[model samples]
Target: MNLDELRTIMRQCGVEDGVDLDGDILDLEWQELGYDSLAVLEITTAVQHAARTPLLEEEVALLTTPRLLLERLGTLTPAAV
Candidate 1:
């Protein structure tokens, strides 16, 4: 998904206005933005629902930043038989 979509998902997940949306946040950790495990789960759930991609809980757990999460989502493709 695109950055706009990710931003929307984050906003829906209760990210405050204090968080910089336009600035570079790729290196920032989710916890640094005040997101706990539950918040991450909520964001991942919303992303999965929007993207119609099946994401594992472990995969979600490993996503430390928005860039990583976006990259992981970008790599999701249907397997061919």
Candidate 2:
């Protein structure tokens, strides 16, 4: 999924809380973004809905940031430097 899709999920999950999701936030930790474990669960649930792939708990725990989450979901294309 892309940032826009993730943003949509976050908004739908009631998670972002006004943070500038459009900003450079891919590297920010979910905790830094004010997301707790429950929030993370919510996010994963939303991702599962969109991707139609259920994440194992162990796998879900590894998604620490937006970039990591996108990578784990196997949705992010490598960026050109």
Candidate 3:
């Protein structure tokens, strides 16, 4: 997970051109991305497949933008038990 990966994931998520990914996702509403609940769910499914992990429903809800989503996923790095 890097910015490039985040951009790609967002492209897959249907983010239109001209939207900025450098800002806070929460500041951008769902309507800005042209997404409804179903589209967001589809993006969650795509991210799960791409990342090859199970993302909790709550986690998906927090993915309002590419940057934020990647940041959250980056925090999931495996640690020694």
After superposition on all CA atoms, what RMSD does each candidate show versus the true structure? 5.7, 2.1, 5.7
- TM-score, each model? 0.82, 0.84, 0.56
lDDT agreement with native, every candidate: 0.78, 0.80, 0.63
Q: Native-vs-model 2 lDDT?
A: 0.80
Deviation from truth (RMSD, Å), model 3: 5.7
Between prediction 2 and prediction 3, which has the larger lDDT? 2
Residues 1-81, candidate 1: write the lDDT tens digits. Answer: 776788788887887658876677665889887788899889888988888888888888888888778777884232311
Model 2 lDDT-worst window of ten: 72-81
Which pairs of residues have clashing backbones in candidate 1? none
Q: After superposition, how far is residue 79 of candidate 1 from its true place, in Å?
A: 25
lDDT score, candidate 1:
0.78
Each prediction's total of clashing residue pairs, residues at least 3 apart in sequence or on different chains, is 0, 0, 0
Q: Highest TM-score: which candidate?
A: 2
lDDT of 1 at 46: 90
Better of 1 and 2 by lDDT: 2
- Report how far off residue 58 is in candidate 1 (Å): 1.3
State the lDDT of candidate 2 residue by residue for 1-81, as single tens digits.
777899788777665567877787788898887788998899988888898877889988888988888877778855511
Predicted candidate 3 versus true structure: per-residue lDDT over 1-81, tens digit per residue: 555554566667776677765554443556676677887788667777777767888888877755456556674333311
Worst 10 residues of 1 by lDDT: 72-81
Predicted structure with the largest lDDT when compared to the true one: 2
